[model samples]
Every structure is written in C-alpha cells, then in structure tokens.
Target: MLEALAQNLVYGILIGALYGLAAVGLSLVFGVTKFLNVSHGELLMLGGYASFWLFALWKVDPFISLPAAIIFLLVAGVVFYKLLFGRMVKLAEGDKIQNTLLVGFGLSLILQNLALQFWTADTRSITTAYSGAVFSFAGVRFPLVRVASLVIAFVLIVALQLFLRRTYTGKALRATVENWEAATLMGIDIQRVYLLSFVMGAALAGVAGALVAVGYSIEPAMGMSWTLKSLVVMVLGGLGSITGTFVGGIILGVTESATGFFLSLTYREVVGLVLFLLVLVFRPQGLFGVKEG
Candidate 1:
C-alpha cells in the first residue's frame, strides 16, 4: 500500500509540472495584458496536432519537434493578437476583460470545429520506441517519458524566469505589468509588451501540448478541460508570481492524484473544482497573490 501511494505521489508531481507550465502562460498573459484569452486551450490542442503530424509524416520524435511546435504557435499567436486582441488593448479594464472573454470563447469554438473537421474527432497520442519504458526504484515504477517531461517542463519554466529577470524586454514586460501607464511614461511600448506576452503564452501552451501528446491523449474537445485546469492553478498560485503558479499546479496535481487513490477515479476531476471553489470563497487573492488595495 505504501508503495502504491508513493507511486501515485510520483505520478502526481510529474503531471503537476505540466499543469504548472500550462498555467504559467495563461498567468503571464492575464498579468501583463489583463486580457483573459479563454482560447488558450485550443492553442494547446493545435500544438499537439502539430507534433502529431510531424511525427506521423516524417517520423520525427515528439521531443525533437518541440521547437517546431513553439514556432507554429508563435506565428498563430501573432496572427490571433493582431487580428482579434490588438484592437481591444485600449479599452477600459472592465470592457477589455468582458470583450476578450466573448471573443476568446468564439475563437475557441471556431478552432474546435476546424480541428474536428480536419482531424475527424479522433483521439491522438505520440508513441515512440521508448514510450513504454520505465524504471523502478524501491518498488515504485516511473515512466521514462513522464520523467523526461517533468525535467523539460522544469527547464522551460526556469528559462522563462531567467528571460523575465535578465532580459531588457522581460524587464519592460514586468514594468508594464506593474503599471502600464507608468511604463508608457518611462518610454516602454505597451503594445509591444502586450504582443510579446500573448505570443509567449501561446508558445508555452504549445510546449505543454507537445508534452501532452507524448504523455497522454488529446482530442478536439480536450481544450476546455485543460483551460479550466489552467485557470484553477492560476488562481491557486496567484498572479504575478510564476513560481507560485507552478507550485500551485503541483499542488493541484497531487490533490487529484490523492483523491483518485483514496477515493474514486471519478472524483479526481471533481476535486479540482472543489478546491477552486474553496479557494475563491476563502481567499480570492490566491495562495501567493498579494491582496489588492
């Protein structure tokens, strides 16, 4: 029983890394631009498909094809922002949030239908020669793919942190997030920052999707579920703290894993919603979020 529990815990942490990666992108966009891009999940789905096709056609490894996925999503993000979100940049905060929500939802629906038409509603996953390989330690088994995924996720998250902290554009982004009007006064281009944040968010989502394609199954309808999970983690970790958001993802992953182990598999999905509700009612600022004045 202990071994089983340990195995579940390990699995939780592995999956949690991905949850964190997915939420980080969403958090960045919301924190920087205040535009809630609800279509983020669809972007992830597209990433997964991009990887799937690359592997299916050219026999490319999913891991090696990550750059392709990132590039694809980056271009898609640029088009999306310029066509839809760019116009809403100057709206009042309240209007920006409301309009983005509606537009994002509509975009998600359109993307979903397009995917369905192209992919035919079939579930897809990437299975490499080593996909089923695993290693055991002290009676617990660890899948090689999942472990690699965790490492990759951690590396990407750290790289993002470094980018934000060490690069000039990153500093400008932070400044804008802190105070867009003041950033503008300081000669920072607010529009450029917004565009960069949105594009980066989409790229991160693409990475998460590629990882998911290798570690799990993806379908056209999977977008909303992943989007909600990202939202939950974002709230749990709070805004403006990427590390906190990543930890929040780990917490949610472990919670779901434990619920599945002790209770029923059916309850795993419900547990996240329950936790989200509790957090909202008791501490809307999130675990790491600073309360607004």
Candidate 2:
C-alpha cells in the first residue's frame, strides 16, 4: 500500500505540474482580460496536432516540435486576438463581464467544431524514444516521459513567473490586472497590452497542448475536458494567482490520484467535480484568492 501510494504521489505531482501550467495560463487570460476562454482548449489541441504532425511526418522529436508548435500557435493567438478576442473586448466596453462570457463561449464552440471538421474525432498521441520507459526510485516506478514533461513544464512556469514579476511588460501586465483604469491612465498602451497579453496566454495554452500530446491522448473533444479541468484548478487555486494555480493543481491531482487508487476509476472524475463544487460553496475566493468584497 505504501509503495503504491508513493508511486501515485510521484506521478501525481508530475501530472499536476503540467495541469497547473495550463491552468495558470487560463487564469492570466481571465484575470487580466476579464474573459472566459472556451476556445483555450482548442488552442491547446491545435498545438498538439501541430506537434504530432511534425513528429509523425518529418520524424522531428516531440520536444523539438513543442517549441515549433508554440511559435506557430503564438502567431495563431495573435490572429485570434486581432479577429476575435479584440472584438469581444471592444464589445464589452466598460461592463464586460457578461459580454465576454457570451462572446468567448460562442467562439469556443465555433473553434471546437471547426477543429472537428478538420481533424475528425479520432484520438492521437506521439511516441518517442522514451515513450514507454519507466523510472524506479526507492521501489516506486514512474513514467520517464511524464517526468520529462513535468520538468519542462516546471521550467516554463519558473520562466513565466519571472517574466511576469521582473520584466517591464510583466509589470505592465500586472498593472492591467490590478487596475485597468489606472494602467491606461499611466499611458500603458492599453490596446497593445490587451493584444499581447491575450495572445501570450493563448500561446501558453498551445505549448501545454504540445507537451500533453507527448504523454497523453488528444481528440477533438479533449479541449472541453482540458478547459473544465483547468477551470477546476483555477477555482481551487484562486483565479489569477499564478502561485495559487501551482498549489491547487497538485492538490487536485493528488486527490484524483488517491481517489482512483481507493475507489473506482470511473468515479475519479466525479470526485473531482465534487471537489470543485465544494470549493465553490466553501471557498468562493479559492484557496489563495483575496476576497473582493
């Protein structure tokens, strides 16, 4: 039992790290842009497809394709900003809460169906040199690819955190999140900031998708699950706090891992949903969110 538990914990943390990275991107988009990105999952899916195609066709390593997909999706995100998110933001004007939701949701559906049309409903994954290798540590075994994915995600998280904390753009983005009005008053190029931030967040989601494809499965419908799970982490960790998302991701991952071990695997999702609702009722501010009112 102890061995099984240890194995689960090790794997769970790795899985949670990747999940948290995806969730943090979502949080940043929602926190600063004040919009729900239903299409965010599609952004990830596209990246996954991009990476898989590169590997399956050109024999490119998944890791190498990961950044390639990011660069591609980053451009896609910028286009999405110019065509869709920007329009929604403008439509929101000052009272954007409801409008952003409706707009984003509609956009999500459109993007989802469009992907289905192009890619079909089949599931996909990429096999690599270390695809099935397992690592042993103190009588516990873990998947090597998963470990690598987690390490990559961790590095990306640290780099992003530092970027957000130390750079001029990072400070400017923080200003927008802390107070959009004041940010504009400071002559912070609101339009440019909005465009760049939205695209950057979308690009982050795309990168996550690429990393995930290396370890898991992807289908047209995968986006919805990713969106929901990331939302669970976002709500659990507190919306908009990058640090909180990391903590919340691990908690949710470990909870699911333990539940799967002690109970039916079919009920793992139910356990997660219940946890999400419990947090909603008990900790509306999330685990780390500051109370607004």
Candidate 3:
C-alpha cells in the first residue's frame, strides 16, 4: 500500500510538470496581452501532429521532432500576433478583449476543422524506442518518457525564469505587462514585446504538446480538453505567475491522482470541476494570483 501511494505521488508529479509547461504559455500571453488566445489548444494539436508525422515518415524520434514542433508553432504564433492580435490591440481596451475572444474562438474552430480535414478523426501517437520502458526504484515504478519529460519541463521553466529575470528583453516584457504606456515611454517597442511574448507562449505550448504526443494518443479534438486543463492550471497558479503555474500544476496533479486512486478514473474531470468551483468561491485570485485593487 505504501509503495502504491509512492508510485501515485511520482506519477502525479510527472504529469504535473507537463501540465505546468502547458499552462505557462497561456499565462504569459494573457499576462502581457490581456487577451486569451482561445486558439491556444489548436497550437498544441498542431505540435502533436507535427511530431506524429515526423516520426511516422522519417523515423525521427519524438524528442528530435520536438524542436521542429517548437519552431513551427513559433512561426505560427508570430504570424498570429502580427495578423490577429496586432490589429486587435489597436481597439479600445474592453473592445480589444472582447474582439480577441471572438476572433480566437473562431480561429480555434477553423484550426480544428482543418485538422480534421487533414489528419481525419483518427487518433495517433509517437512510438519511440523507449516507449513503454519503465524504471523501478525502491519497489516503485516510473515511466521513462514521463521522467524525461518532467526533467525537460523543469529545465525549460528554469530557463524561462532566468530569461525573464536576467535578460533585457525579458525585463522589457515585464515592464510592458506592468504598464504598457510606461514601457513605451521608456523606449520599449510595445508591439515587438507583444510579439515576443505571444511567440514564447506558443513555443511553450508546442513543446508541451510534443512531449505529450510521445506518451498519449493525439487527435483533432484532443486539444480542447488540454486547453481547458491548461486554463485551470493558469487560474490555479494566478493568471500570470510562472512559479504559481508550476505550483498549481503540482497541486492539481496530486489531487487528480489521489482522486483517481481513491475513487475512480472517471471521476477525474469531476475533481477538476470541483477545484475550479472552490477556487472561484474561495479565492478567485488563485493560489498565486494577486488581488485586483
């Protein structure tokens, strides 16, 4: 019984890392742009498909294809910012946000249909040489791919933290998020910063998707569930808090794992709904979110 509990903890942590990675991009974009990219999940879908096809055709490993997914989504993200968000930013604040929502929702629909047309409704996954391989320690079992993904997620998160804390552009990004007008007065090109932040978010989502594709089944409609889950993590962590996002993911992972063990796998989504409600009723600002003045 103790060993099983330990295994559940390990599994939850592993899943939570990926969950955090998925949420970070959404959090960052919403923080800087004040616009929720509802199409964000489609970006994950694209990344998964990109990795899937690469592996299917060239025998490339999913990890090897991950960079390709990131690059592909990065370019798509920048283009999205330039075309849709760039124009939307020109509107009045309230109007801008509302319009962004409508446009993003439409974008998601379009992408989903496009994916269905191309990839069909068939589910897919990347099978690597190490797929299904397991590691055991102290009578506890760990999936090797999940462990690699967790380590990579941590490394990426730390790298992003350092970038935001130590780099010039990163500082500019934070400044812009705090006050775009002030940032612009200080000679920061707000549009460029926006582009960079949005692109970074997309890249993070893509990387997470690629990692997920190695371990799970992928399909055109799979993105919506992940997107919703990512949103939950972002809210749980506080809308724009990087550290908060990771912590939130960990909390969610453990909760869902415990629920699944004690109750059943079918109750997992119900647990998510419960968490959402609790957060909304008790602390809408989220665990890491700051209260609006």
Top candidate when judged by TM-score against the true structure: 1
Q: Which ranking of candidates, highest TM-score first?
A: 1, 3, 2
- Between prediction 2 and prediction 3, the one with superior TM-score is 3
For model 2, what is the C-alpha lDDT against the true structure? 0.83
| 138 Cα displacement, candidate 2 (Å) | 1.6
lDDT of 2 by residue, 108-199 (tens): 78877887898788888999888999978899987888888888887888888899999999989989987888999998987788877788
lDDT of 3 by residue, 28-119 (tens): 99888888888888888888888899999999999877889999999999888887888987688799889998988888898899999988
Residue 180 in model 1: lDDT: 97
Cα RMSDs, all models? 1.0, 1.8, 1.5
TM-score of 3: 0.96
Candidate 1: tens digits of C-alpha lDDT, residues 1-293: 99999999999998999999999999999999999889999999999999999999999999999999999999999999999999999999999999999999999999999999999899999999999999999999999999999999899989999999999999999999999999999999899999999999999999999999999888999899989999999999989989889999999999999999999999999999999999999989899888765
Choose the strongest candidate by lDDT.
1
Instruction: Indicate whether candidate 2 or candidate 3 has the larger lDDT.
Output: 3
Name the lDDT value of residue 171 in candidate 3: 94
Error of 3 at 148 (Å): 0.4
Evaluate all candidate structures by whole-model CA lDDT and list the values in order. Answer: 0.95, 0.83, 0.87
Q: State candidate 2's TM-score.
A: 0.94
